[model samples]
Target chain A: MKLLELVALEKRYGERPVLRGVDLAVDEGERVVLVGPSGCGKTTLLRLVAGLDAPDGGEIRLAGEVVSRAGAVIVSPEARGIGMVFQDLALWPHMTARENVAFPLRARGVPRRERDRRVAELLELVGLPDAGDRRPAELSGGQRQRVALARALAAEPRLLLLDEPFTSLDPELADRLRGDLVALQERLGFTLLHVTHDREEARQLATRVVTLHRGHLGEEAR
Target chain B: MSRRLVLGSAVLLLAIAGGLPVVAMLAQAFFAGGRFDPAPLAGLLTDAGTWRLLGSSILLAAAVALAACAAGIPLGVLLARTDLPGRRLLAALFTVPLLLPPWVLAVAWAALAGREGLLAPVVGPGAALALDRFLYGPGGCVLVLGTAFLPVPLLLTMAALAEIDPRLEEAGRLHAGWGTVLVRISLPLALPGLLLAAVLVFLLALGEFTVPGFFRVDVFATRSLERFAAFYDVRGATAAALPLAAAALLVLPLESAFLGRRGAPLPGAGTRRRTVPLGRFRAPALAGVLFVAGVLVALPLSALAARAAAPGAFREALARAGDALPRTIAWSVTGASLLLLGGVLLGLVVGRRELPGWRAVDGLALFLFALPGAVTGIGLVALWNRPATAFLYGTPLVVLLGWFARYAALPLRVTTAHLRGIPPALEEAARLAGASWWLRTRRVTLPLLGRGLFLAWIVGYVFCARDTAIAMLVYPPGRDTLPVRIVTLMANGTPGMVAALCLLATGVVLLPVAVVLPVLAISGREDRR
Candidate 1:
């Protein structure tokens, strides 16, 4: 089954149409990577999928649930059960790695013990068990990415969204993390939609690659 | 063409608003006694009252500055660094005193600490234990002014604290503990800003006149005004003003020494998170915050409320205000409009064009920022209060000129800052696009500066409305601004009247906040750029 589907999604800023009609889909447990140059609506697509922004037209369906419909209902990010790691990481500076991972669980009203247990396991999963007490500011570029990933996975999300997550990390660390992420996804059996400008990263990580050009999405073989 | 016209118009308006009355005042002072006489200088220097007032003023200002620093710094740290409970509410509450005019706070404080005030019922008469005695002397002046001016340092320190890269704290947290993080990283980074804030608060406190006047404490400001208005000793008043002006000038060095190199941006941008969670000591901190807010806002408001409840007092005050309100409005509106116009013109001249003595002109405009209002009033009155200058005195023009001279800095500062932000390349581009200098300014520059001009006008208006010292000395018989009227009512022992009028006056002072807050909110949503 398709885990996520966008039908003729369009967005505009005043007279300028930033995202023209775009259609795309990702299968369940599939690793889909989006590649494009800057300002080619790559981040905009991610934001639309994450429900941070509303599309000017068309529909978005996630897990067979109609998440957005033009001129009708639109689901909020929290309600959509979609997890996102922003390009800038957007990690709450005040929260520790553990607390950040525990946030979605807390928001979903998971009990404190269970939340802590899940957070610890996730921190260990991301190889940052000891770093859980440190805030995002304390961590290195790569460590922060792991904390972000650990946070996104805390709610046991069906689909994970990563936007240029490894862009700020060192190349070696990025490659290592990419391998770890792929292994983690395979082990966890979760679908992933990642956005990056690097073609090499797309080839290395994606099962299927999609290219966004002037807001039009075209499937490309990895 | 339209934009240039608007720019020119705006400048013209500011000039008219700020310049004419100043010219009138100078004319009055210099030509009043058939010629300028330096005789009053000797009399002013010899007067024991003048010396006493100056000493008291300096002491009061120093005390207030210290008190403000003591309260403001800790609160700034707590608000910025900790996940203290109700931090947002506490931040907002702290700004309330800043919005209120000093005279309004003075009147409210008087009602609370006076002999017949709310505490009188609980403490009994002649109770040395009561705050009434403290409220009427040097102690009262410092307390009231300190509380009133605390927001400046609090804001500056908070901004500084927020700018500290959160990563540094996080690194410290990883290596050591929260205590170590705060001591080693946060406090050191925030020190420059805190010292800068202290200097700013001190400078502001030094110029304050209304609070001291309300407390019946003779300060330099009041003494200067008395010399001019009562004794008609123009030279004496001018001489009296020299020291205060010198003290005000002291701020320039302090500002440069402490704050010049520090480039910490305010906390409005780059803040990813809205709330920071508290780990421990939340409840006690919350209680302390609540207690401070209660004392600062609730106590004074309650005193005013009590006085307003008295029989016929509110009505009587309202009736008097009703009689005075139109004239007050006219004076403030006219004065501010003139000041804004003058400031914009002066700012534009200083900003875009290089001319002889332009730096001196700029300095003269900013000079009033440091000088106490009484000193400015004294200087103007001294220069204008002559037999030959009879045309300027006993006329509304003198008041208007004083308002302009005192407040031109607002528009000039705002305009210059705004102008600096608009890249010169834009103007060059317009020129490259076949636009004449006049056309480019009209179509491009003026339109861009609309918001700045509006804001400058609003600030100028608020300053004019809130000022009492300058208005008190220079106001002709027919023109009394709201603050002057409020001060007069307080001086005459009409606490009820004072409270009512002050409340009314404060609304005028805070009008700009109503407009500014919404614009800020909308802007915050639009850009992190």
Candidate 2:
């Protein structure tokens, strides 16, 4: 099944088109990586899919539901059950790992006991169970990325968006995390759309790769 | 290139102007009775009035600080975090009270809340009961001072809030609620900045003279001013000023200690982009913001406008002010120029080289910043009123010196900040190129510091123009500045004329700066955008 689909996406700032005539699709449980140079609409595409932004001209369908459509309807990120890890990790510097992991569940009005149970399981799954009580500031760069991942997965979203999530981490940790991410994705059966400027990171993590150049999506590869 | 030279010259001139009054005053204080008098020192410690004044001043300052913090913190949060409607308009309105002279605010408050004033018409017979009686006492002093100085904390809080990483709030939003986000993340991150702002506001409130004086509240500043103007007792006033100065000294260490702690890092690379929507609260919040702005900007201005429109008020005030306008402007401009010159020279001297006790010198320069204008005036009067120090007193020079001493901090701070931005390599390169010290400074350093110089001059000029406390005490007989003229006219029951003169004075002082500010703002916004 098509987990996510964007048809003829277009975005403009004033007179300048940022993202124009873009179409894409990702299958269930598939890890698709989008690669582009700066200002090439790679991040914009991820943002659109995550529902952080609205498309100027497009229909976005997730799990066979029309989430966003031109001149019709648009779903909020929270309402769409979409999880995103921004380029900055966007981890709450003030929250402990456990608390961060429990956030999305809390937002969904999960009870404290079940929230705690799920949070602990997610932390252990991310290989940071021991660091559950530590704040993001107290964690290493790689640990912070893990916390972000754990937080994103807390709500049990069907699809996940990662925007250069490992850019700030050391190369060795990035490699280790990429392996862990693939293993977790396989186990969880959650589709992923990851955006990165690093070709090596895209090549390593992607089951399918899509190249974006100057606001246009190029040939897709498997 | 010429602009740099003009800016450099202005800075150099203002510094000298700022320093002369303090120098003259200190000379007089030390040389009294042919030596520094111990009698005045004893009088200062033992006087009942002095202690009462000190206690009242401290209490008033504390009250004002708390009030300002309470008002400013929430407003700052609304501005920085929430997508409050008219946030831009509120931000601009918040700064209006800061620019208006304290005397103007006090008079407006008096007109509105005083007996037989505006509120009387609405409140009718039971008006006295409805209004707080203490509004003219220490309580009123605190209220006026707090309202006047609230913008400082508001500005500081906004700056601090802007620096906080928004992702912290998002993290909380994901886990808990907006309340959790505020208490756990926003408050803790903004605490240091808020506290620093509180301390500075407290210091300023403690030193304030005009509000207390107009409201019949007897704080240290008012008492010190009284001693000089009413009795010409310079020694007595100087002695009274000592305790307030000592209190200021105590606060200095505490302020530095708070500032030493690390603040939240500013939003930059790797920081999340998040703007919390105001949601349903948008309309009501915007209304609340607008109401506050209306009360702050409209109340005093309306009262002044009404007074200006009264029969013969505008014509009489303008006629009198017209005679004094040229002299006032000349004194303010000349004094500011001298102050700028001295500040730049001193800044270059202290900032460039690794001189022994440079830190101490910098500390001393900032020391007078804490002293109230009235206290400084009293000290100056004490020092210069002696026969031996007659050369510096009762002259136009005395008035100029008084303005310079009171406002020296402006140019000094500007020049010092500017000097720090210049690269040391440029100077080293100039030296290696065989340029003399004077040549390098004149050609390279002066050009680099042009903007700083212009800013310093403007700051000094505005401060000199608006200042009344020190200028009142030492304006020699017929050489009163605009503020002094307004104050004297108000005290003598010429309310209508005083209001007109104030509007004109404020306009004259603010117009040039106001005209340039938008251009500067546009350029700044363009750069950032």
Candidate 3:
């Protein structure tokens, strides 16, 4: 069964349309990657799915529930149980890596012991075992990405959204992170909707590669 | 809901509380003969005494700005680059004088040079008398205002300095010595911020009435007041204040240009990685800070407190202005809240929207902020003193209107600037985590806005608390604000009693700031930009 559906998704800024007539779907455990050039609204489409923003004229359904339309949220972002790793790695600078990872659990009112245990397990899984106390600023570029990944996975999200999450890292680090993320996704068996401009990353990580052009989702490449 | 709607609300709030009063004042001034004639306003404008008042105001503002820059620049550099002792504490202490009314400093200086003052015995009688004479004129206005305003430049320069890439300074250091590099590179880069701060000081000094009034120095603000409060010449008062408003109107654009949409961001949650050791200059910089604190912060406060320390002086002052004290406190809180409300709305507009219309709103807010307090006060009276609006005019509401009109820009600018730096993802992440809008605001938005909200309150409250020029005109009979009460009581009350009241007012303003600043600094997220 489809875990996510974008039905004729359209978005615009005034008269200029950014994402027009975009249709897409992903199965419950499919690892789908979206590839696009700059300013192709890849991020916008992801934002719409995550309920970060509302589309101008379309509907988004998550797990068979209408979530967002042109100007309304049928289900709020948080209530949708979505987890997103932001393009810039929007880890709260005020929080340590451990706290950043644990915040979603805390927000969900998880007990302190459970939150701490999960946070540590996720950190260790992401290869950031000893960097839990360090702020995002103190961590290296690759480490920050790992911490973000750990955070995205902390809620045990049914679907995970990644938006150019490895863009800022060096090529080697990006490749390594991409491989680890693919392996993790396979192991966890969660549906993945990731946006990236790198064809190699998509080829390596995705079971299906989709392209967006002029706000329209092109035919599936794989 | 819509950006336009939010901005429209802000503009409407400003129009009611601030813009209408000026409109009423202008109408009164221009149509004094009950026609469209500009004869009275024209005559007042071209008059020699009017020109003299304008000249003196310009002169005073220039002198104060110059003095403030002179004091603020080196201190700013010291705080920013050098490993100064207790820099945060010093920065907070620097704003101490500013939290009090300008006139109180004049009162403190008066007490300091009096025959029974602290300095009377140390300094010879002749010297003390000479000092007394000096403290009661334009020199005194510049001295007091310059000291109060020094932090304006210092804070701005520190923020600007932080924004400068330290590598540029280091690159310069490879070629030239630190002093040469500082004068050549760091100083040049920070000039715009320094000048912007100076312009603020200029506008502030130009708009001030209290210091000059206490010193018996005749500037435009004092002239405007005397015409309204003393001689009951509303038209003449309006005429006198028109030039001051014109000055504000002319300068507001420059302020916007210099400060940008964010109204000149200040140093916050700065890292100490870029600091330079002062070496031999350390002692002098520390000594300079000490001297500034002594002259600007410590000395005047000691004198004021000493004068008030006489038995029953403080109590008598409080008893005399009993209702006025609480009334001032209560109105100031209400006024600050109102100001913050308008400020948040306007700030969101200015910070978020890139449209030119928001700039117009910004210009209007800044113009009203810099418009002479007497002008704002008289404008409120003219606008509200009528049968239809008699309820507002007959109570403290008019005074609150004056407060929001003149000072709301402060919080708006501060909050907007802070909001600008906060990424949209910060809230989105929270929202996607299942936090409701209310929960997001309380946890995400409010935490980010932590100190900024409190700082806005302080800015709004300090201005409202010490305000006199506007309060003096708009305050209803049998009701008095603390600043107005203290100034008026100076005539009938003993010197010691007045001094105690000034000290008491300072304490009132400082307590909240003292408690709030450190807590926010420590607890608030390291902005780590």
Candidate 4:
């Protein structure tokens, strides 16, 4: 079943057209990796999908409900039931691992006891149970990556969007995190729409791979 | 043009506008006639009266800074971080006092708390007497100057908060509400800016003369002005100004050593900023903002309005000080234009660190900025009142030069900050495309800086127009700005007439911003599209 759909999406900054009349879809429990060069509208597409930005022209539907259309957002980002791990790994530097992981639950009105249990479970699942009290700044790069991943999954998002989340890590660390991510996805059974510049990364994690070139999506390769 | 030419031009401009005046003043102080003399300088420095005045100035400045920061920080958080209603309007309202001369606030407060003032009817005469007494001393000086300078920390806080990596907030948003995110993420990140604001407020309040002078509080700034304007004692004025200048000079290094690196760009500095929703608390937050605005801005302005409502008050103001308006406009325009030119050139050289001594140049300009307007005016007169420079000194050029000396830092800082926000790659790409330095700066750099330059020009114009201390000291006879005119007329002018003049001066200062900001906003929107 389709979890997310984009119909002829378009975006522009000034006179510079970024995303142009692009159509795409993602299915439940499937990993779709989008490969594109920098500034080719990969992040723009992710932001549009996450409802952080409205398209200049197009419609974004999640779970068959329109979330965004040309120049307007029907559903705000937090209500879109989508979790994004930004390229910068955007962990709140002031919050400890446990607090960061528990944030989504708290936002959704989860009680403190249940929130704590869920946060601890998420931390253990992310292999950082012992690092729960450590802030993002005190954690290692890879540990920080794990914390971000844990935070993203804390709310049990229906669709997870990763915008080159591991790009900053060394190849060795990135490779390990990608492996851990795939295992987590398999265990959690969540739909994934990931963007990357690494073809090897796409090969390792994608159930299906598509290339974005000059604002057009190429045929999917499984 | 070559880099050498650019550096040389900046040096010459700085020397003429800022450096030479200070050097000439110090030279005059240390040399009697043609020979070096230290006795007079030494005697003046050691005077008990001088120390007492300096102590009073320091205490006043410190109190004002603390009070401003205390009020301003929370106000900034509300305006910048929260989803407060009328945030933009509230911000603009709070900024009104900063654009006017600080003494306007003193005048407004006095009118509100005086014997026949607004509060007298409201609180009855007995309590009003106590408030009146409080309004005319050190406490009153702090209240007026603190309110006048509050926008420094408030605006700085907003700017700093705006510069935070929004992604951090967004990540927080995905999990928690805005209240948590602001407390945990946004305010912590913006702490450096808040601290910088406190330091700036302290310096500004210390250097302020008009507010303290109006309240009958004798700080060093007033002493410096009194010695020169009242007694024509150049030596005494120079002696009075030396400690203030030294104090400002010391702060330069401390600011450099402490807060210099705090402004380094955050990772992902240019990302889209997201606003926190006020949600259920919007009405209360808005009411709180309005209350603060009412107390700080509206109440005082309303006093001026009520007083000025008398028949023919504005006409009387125009009749008495009407000529000063045209002179104010011309000088402010000329001063702002010159400041813009000097600012852009200096901003580029210092911001890009193209010269080895850019830090020193930057520090020197900032020290001049922190130096009281009276000090800069004294310096300019000492430098230009010679037979050879009589043509320059006897005209309005001396006044314009004093303005450039004191307030050039506004445009310079604004331009430098704006330049920093533009990525180096834009210019480097032009360079790689075979563009010369001049061509790259014109085509690639300056276009990106258009909004910033416009903003700087407006700020420069307002400061030049509203200046009291420097204009009073250095303006050629019959060439005073509106602020100086108002100060001159205050002694014998009726209360209604004085209030009318203050309102007219405010209108003049606001007219450009009111006309330009909307146009800039529309242009900004068009650019975004």
TM-score-sorted candidate list, best first: 4, 2, 3, 1
User: What are the runs in model 2 whose C-alpha is more than 4 Å off?
Assistant: A59-74, A77-82, A90-140, A143-158, A183-190, B1-55, B78-87, B128-134, B165-187, B226-239, B246-280, B319-324, B334-371, B375-460, B473-477, B518-529
Best by DockQ: 4
Off-target runs (Cα >4 Å) in candidate 4 are A1-84, A91-161, A168-193, A206-222, B1-3, B24-53, B250-271, B420-426
Per-candidate DockQ values are 0.03, 0.21, 0.01, 0.33
Give lDDT per model, in order: 0.73, 0.73, 0.79, 0.84
True contacts kept of each: 0.00, 0.24, 0.00, 0.41
- Whole-structure CA lDDT of model 1: 0.73
**Model 1, runs deviating above 4 Å:** A1-222, B1-53, B78-92, B123-129, B159-193, B257-259, B262-277, B342-363, B386-394, B413-431, B434-454, B515-529
Kindly list the per-residue Cα lDDT of model 4 for residues B327-378, writing each as its tens digit.
Answer: 8888899999988888778888788777778887788788888877888888
How far is B74's C-alpha from truth in model 2 (Å)? 3.3
Question: Best-fitting candidate, measured by TM-score?
Answer: 4
Question: How large is the interface RMSD of candidate 1?
Answer: 11.7
Model 1 DockQ (Cα-based): 0.03
Cα lDDT tens digits, model 1, B279-368, are 567888888878987887779878877876777776877787765677776777787788776777667766765344545556566556
lDDT of 2 by residue, B14-52 (tens): 344334434544444445757765576676668786777
Return the lDDT, model 2, position B77.
81
C-alpha RMSD over true interface residues, model 4 = 2.3
Write the residue-wise lDDT of candidate 3 on B75-170 in tens digits. Answer: 888887778888977877786777788888888877786556789789989988778778878888888889888888888888767755543443
Candidates by DockQ, descending order: 4, 2, 1, 3
